[model samples]
Target: MIYDGDEVEQELCVDLYWSFRSPYSYLALHHVRALAKAYALRWNVKVVYPLAIRTPDFFKRMDHMWRPYLLIDTQRIAESLGMPFRRPVPDPIVQDPRTLLISLEQPHIHRLTRLGAEAMLRGRALELVDAVGTMLWDGSVDGWNQGDHLARAVAAAGLDLQDMETAIARDPQARDRLIETNEAELRAAGHWGVPTFVFRGEPFFGQDRVELLLWRLRQHGLQARSN
Candidate 1:
């Protein structure tokens, strides 16, 4: 029973972010729903393209070191959460700047993000976001390998994929703008990583940091002293 400060007095917005290509983002999506429910908070999913795009050489270098660390860390986290996770086949998005081959630039990604924003506008963003996030995190479906998996994920959220696609494709400028807007918002929130949570302008990066955000929320609500 947390009370909202002014305005609607019913919900608090937790800016939830993730990169479509990031395995850690996949892992973090696992616990987001439960955390939101526990805190009585509504999550606004902010999907951003990974930094790998901006730094191609950095990605190539990190591919040797950071990728292994990502795999090990994500597996450990997923095991702890008892969530099923598999290395995404084809890796969802490749770190290529020339083509933007990753799902981050896919029509599906744009459609989904737009739909998410629409949901937020309509006040049903929380539930829609939870459902979509869960499906995206459920690695049993092989998001990268399965062709129909994304459409299924979108449908599960009570959204019409065909209609969304039609709408998204019809407005290329708007899609680009949306992507740019999310990217700007991510940067403004601090770090550009997925699973980043922003509360009252404070950014907490990673699923592991979720507890920290919860603590901050509690402190804000209860007026607890910081030690």
Candidate 2:
């Protein structure tokens, strides 16, 4: 499916802090894209590394039940939204299977996250993530990072993977710094989570808060585009 860019007037703007490794972020894409289509709004897509990468000790500090509950809850949310849900095969962030301890040498997530930042720079952040997120989380394909899967997803988003890669390689650190800035901005917005949407300085965290976000947007005079 082709994505619609912000073709209408920029009546409102939203900052979305998304993570490639977050299943909730993947679930949130459906609503995010829908909101973009239904309203004349500008989206400032800020893709950041998941908590697993940003804070290596985050999961370790969590209760033993955190992972199980996350899986269960994300699956339920995906089903309720009629979207396919699966933990990415070879999960984006490399980790020990038995210990569930994160690895420092994370090749997959670093590259993916950097590409996300590059996409945002190219003004196709939502399109790139929407296509890539579906490919990674939809349960339709495995080895999402291998073959031409990622390249095709990038193409679907109207971008070329090689171009994006070259752009990132030119200044990889700069891309990473942008992600760090997004993390800081996210915290400043009063939340620290993937799929956090900030509108007019108010932070709405989680996929479940989409309605509330919409309600807030509506209160601020969000106007729908006439088809």
Candidate 3:
């Protein structure tokens, strides 16, 4: 869908997503918000699990090829965007809390998605989601075991993480429903990947494709284009 810069009075909304463990997602997180603001668009963060969990063997094999590409591509993107990119001291997923690991088999996916939903509900979705993304990507904070990292990030977006945690703990069903719905929605979008952007029902997979979506938005004035 193309968004007309001139005609649209209301902000064009697009879904922004990422997997907590995805380095590419981390890279994309750095500039997605600024891009949205520049285009007068509203970003709707939709945290989803990486494709690795869905197809583990394929991901393992792909990782052999992808790791190098991930490092190189992210560095290039960081350079182009003038953003600082460093590999965090401790990997977020590898060093996560055991209790957290037990609570959610994929803690990164589950926690991110739950937080995204909560932020959406509270009307601070974009900001909170962006903060979380920065935490994951910026390389300043070791996201793995920063003690109060999540809480601080949430609070930075003006949310009460303590309350959010209480709610999530009290309502497992809610979190499950949100995750199930997110997965279903993602599948329906024709790309089972994080850092996917959906504009006017058309799915653009990968951070590299954001510019393509922007071009389409400018050209089509918010109308969906079929592949």
Candidate 4:
């Protein structure tokens, strides 16, 4: 994982907007990492707050079929991809089940978003999120937000979680502003959802559009790196 003195060539830049609480984002993360590594592309990430918390009005008026269909579709997609799938324990957003109204308390998610920004600063956000989000979404770990789970995941991604937490604590306002900026960029990119990939101002939204992105990348002369 160490980079030598030789400078790496960069070509396309993918502005990836994702959410920690999104199952689709969980599923698409590894692919994004692979896409970046497989070709000469600058894989930039913009982590944002989930729609449930970001837009309360829309969350309240969302189509009734949205949640149920999302659950069903995620399960189906997980099965097709041979990935472990399960509903998160104490879901990321603590909401009233009846009204689906998001709660004001979001200790876990706020920490995640803040640390996600830290990871990005360290140039490892995609890898860190891919590792930790899968644990939460795939049911591999319980109480993902508790104990040393997150720390271990960060370490595995070649970062110190304690250091990241420390840095974030040092400037809460800066991290908050970065997240706000990311949300604004996501909206400006013509998409407000997780897993939206924007390449040179063109937006490809959704986990299923990865192939489409690849096609466009190929059109721009993307090629596999010589081993």
Total clashing residue pairs per candidate? 3, 0, 5, 0
Q: Write the per-residue lDDT of candidate 2 for residues 143-224, one digit (tens) a residue.
A: 9888998999999999999999998999999999989999999999999988999987899999899999988777666789
Residue-level error in angstroms, candidate 3, position 220: 4.4
Alpha carbon lDDT at 193, candidate 1: 69
Tell me the deviation in Å of residue 212 in model 1: 0.8
Q: Model 3, range 1-227, lDDT digits (tens) per residue?
A: 33445665555678776666676777776557657546666777766655555454444355455666877987888888777777654543433333222222455556666776767667787778667767766767864345888788888899988787778778767766766677788888887877788877899988788779878766655433232
TM-score of 2: 0.94
Displacement of residue 37 (Cα, Å) in model 3 is: 2.4
lDDT of 4 at 102: 80
RMSD of each candidate relative to the true structure = 5.5, 4.9, 5.7, 4.6
Leading candidate by lDDT: 2
Q: In model 3, what are the clashing residue pairs, if there are any?
A: 2-217, 2-221, 2-222, 3-217, 17-195
lDDT of 1 by residue, 1-227 (tens): 45557633445667877665566766666567666445566667765655655444555454456656876888888888888767544444443534433334544444556666555444565556555555665555655335776667666777765666676567656755656787788789797767688887889988788778777777556332222
Ranking by lDDT: 2, 4, 3, 1
Model 4 lDDT per residue over 1-227, tens place: 22223322345678889888899998886577677678777778878888877886776688998889988998999888878888777688888888887888888778888888888888987777877787778887788878887788878888898888999999988988998999999889898988899987889999999999999777666658665
Better model by TM-score, 1 or 4?
4
**How close is every model to the real structure, measured as TM-score?**
0.76, 0.94, 0.79, 0.92
Q: Which stretches of candidate 2 lie over 4 Å from their true place?
A: 1-10
In model 1, which runs have C-alpha deviations exceeding 4 angstroms? Answer: 1-10, 61-63, 95-137, 142-147, 222-227
lDDT score for candidate 4 against the true structure: 0.82
Query: Looking at candidate 3, what is the lDDT of residue 137?
Result: 69
